[model samples]
Structures are given as C-alpha cells and as structure tokens.
Target: MPHTLFIADLHLSAGRPDITAAFLRFMAEEAPKADALYVLGDLFEFSIGDDEQSPLNRRVASAFRDCGVPVFFIHGNRDFMVGRRFAREAGLTLLPEHQVIDLYGEPTLIMHGDTLCTDDAGYQRYRRITRLGWLQWLFLRLPLKKRLGIADGIRGKSAEAKQDKSITIMDVNQGEVARQMRKAGVRRLIHGHTHRPAIHRFDLHGQPVQRIVLGDWYTQGSVLVVTPETETLQGLSLGENR
Candidate 1:
C-alpha cells in the first residue's frame, strides 16, 4: 500500500550511536518503501550551522541521499540552523514551520510543534531571538569551535530549564493547536517536538479534527505510518541496551 511516514525528535548525535544505527536501518528498511517521508524536526541533537557539517552529518546526509523516496524536513527548535546547504547535501526539501498538504484526499497540516507551546513565554521569546536572520548570521560567523561551545552551553541550560518547567507548559497549548488547524482548514495535524506521542481528537464546531504527536528517539524509536485506510504509531524497543 502506498503510504507516508512521519518522524521527529530523533536528536541524532555521535553520543547516541545506537539510535543512529537504528535510524540508518530505518532508512534502509522502512523509509524507502514509503511513498514519501516527512521528518518533522530535531533530526540532530544540535546543528550549529550548515557550514559546520561534521563527519556524522555527512554520513546522515549520505543515508538520506540513498533513501529513494522523497524526503522533507521541518526545522525543529533544536536543529533550526539547518540551511540550504545541508538540505541540498542531504537530498531533502525543507518545508516551512506550518505547511498544509493533501494527504490521501484530506488536507493535513504539518509542523515542528514548538510554536504551539505558546504557554512557554520565555522559550517563545528565546525562539524569536534565535530565529532572527541577523542573529543567526552573526552566530554562524563565529569560529567553529566557538560556535560549538556556545551551542553546548545553551543546550545545557535548556536541559536544566526543562527540569524545572511544568509538563503542561512544555507541551503544546490546546488552544494554539486548534487555532492553527482552523487557520489551515485542516482536520488532521501532524507534528513532533514535545516528545509526548499520542493521538488527540478535537471537536471544532461540529467537525472532528485529529492531532498526531510524534515521539522522540531518546530511549526508543517511534514512527507514525499513515495510509488511506489506517494511521498508527509504532515503537522500536531498546530492550536491555537502553
């Protein structure tokens, strides 16, 4: 059956070789068989800049290049620095934060899901600052070593901050989700970010809408497969290794 696959928050890095291996296996075994593959966001743990593609990034790009099916990427908060250079090298198309597309006869909206967490005011402010073109350009101009050091520092702080944040704040705001879906005129929405994978059904003025959250690859692998007839979330067990 022709179907599409959605994945997010793999957070692939040299530190997580097992997860990386699993992803490569996925590209080889699962992705190519699908009609199209949508990588919602955070494919890497951190991407300093496209100009700083490390050996691991090169390998990942090569893997995508070999995946036969069309691949699309949405920039997650963690890897928003991925630019045209990386996209070209990886053989993938980069989509905007919120995109609506026809999915098996239904209009579906896709996103990285960070913007929907509007309750996190501080994080939202940080996002805006970091995403400014001028700021990103300035950051990219720094020496590679400096850029990496800054990224590591920021990541550490973000991890610490998450430990203190309420779960509700970290997750998407229901109102925001509803607003976005309505704006896009889509009954189905797919995104990855919060790492809380679940299917949420909403009733909007006599219409039914579904929101699908993709899981993070921190401990196990998760993917959402959608065909015309069915949509399901499947997990890859890490077992004793995790």
Candidate 2:
C-alpha cells in the first residue's frame, strides 16, 4: 500500500541530542518506505539562513535524500530561514503554506498553523519582523559561529516567554481556523505547530470539516499516515509500538 506520512514540531537542535537521534532513526528506518513524507515545519530549532547549514541540518537533509521517496517541506516560525538552495541540495521540494493538494482524490489543505495565532497579537508582530526578506539576507551573510550564538540567545528568550504564558494564549484561535478553511475551499486541514495532536471533525457552514494536528517530538512522537484503506495517525515513544 502506498502511504503518505506527515510530521512536525520536532524543534531539533544541536543541543537536543535525543531528538536528533530520534529524527535520524526515523529517516533511516521508517521514512524511506513511505510513498511520500511531508515535514510540516519546525524540524529545526533555528536555521540561520541558507548560507550556513548546521551539521545536524546536513545530516538530516542527506537522510531525506537517501530515503528515495518524495520529501516536501514548509517553513515553520522556527525554521523559516530555509531557502530554495537548501531544498535543492537536500533533494526535497519546498511546499507553500495554505496549499491544497489531492490526497487520494480528497482535497486537503496544509499549513504550519502559526497564522492562526491571530489572538496572540504580540507574537504575530514578532513573526512579521523576523520574516522580512532583507533582514534574513543580512543575517545569512554573518559567520556561522555568530549565527549560532544569535540562535542560542533567541531560543533562550523564547523558552522564557513560553514559560510565562497561559495555554489559551499560546494555542490557535478556532475562529481563524474556520475562516482559513472557508478561504481555501477545503473541508480537510492538516497542520502542525501547537503540538496538540488529534484528528478533529467539525461542522462548518453545514458541511463536515476535518482538521488533523501533528504533535511534538518532545514527549513522544506523532505521525499521520494515509493509505488507500485507511487514514490513520500513530503516536509512538522511544520504546512504544509503532
């Protein structure tokens, strides 16, 4: 059976040795057999532009390339610095957020889900600033050591902010999700970011809509697997059943 696999919110960093190992194992053992693999985003804790690829990034990219299966990626807030050259080098295609693709004839839209952070005005402002093209270009030109230093500093600050926030303020806004679904003209939405994993079926404008959320690689792991007979999701841990 041909199967499509999806994962996200890994937040892999040079510092996070466990996650790096887990990710490599996934690529080597599982991903190659899939018909397609979609990395929704945040695979990296921080990507300091395209000019300097971290050792972890290089290894991960090589793994995907060697998988001999189609690999698609979309930038998340954390790794938005990923560019076209990196994608080409990794033998992966860059997928646009808010894109609709036919999945076994079912029209499905995919996103990183950060745009649903409409309720969090402050974070949205910060997102806009960091995503600027010129700013990213300037940052990419710096030395790798300097870039690493900056990324470390930024990660520390982000961790502190998350600790200070309430859960409600950090999650996606339901209203925004509905609006996006309507705009996309799709009844199915798949995204990763909130680290809350589940398949949600809801009523939208008198129609049935489904939203699938991919979880984090922190506690355990979550993957969406779609085949002809069934569309299933698996949540696995280090020693858990796959």
Give the winner by TM-score: 1
Candidate 1, which segments miss by more than 4 Å at Cα? 238-242
Clashing pairs for predicted structure model 1, backbone only: none
Instruction: Give the Cα-based TM-score of candidate 2 against the true structure.
Output: 0.94
**lDDT, candidate 1, 1-242, per-residue tens:** 98999999999998888888888888988999999999999999999999886888998999999999999999999999999999999899999999998889989999999999999999999999999999998999999999999989999999999999999989899899888988999899999999999998879878988999999998899999999988899997644422
What lDDT is reached at residue 25 by model 2?
78
Error at 189, model 1, angstroms:
0.6
At residue 44, what lDDT does model 1 achieve? 95
- Candidate 1 structure lDDT: 0.92
Each candidate: RMSD: 1.5, 2.3
Worst 10 residues of 2 by lDDT: 233-242
Candidate 1 least-lDDT 10 residues: 233-242
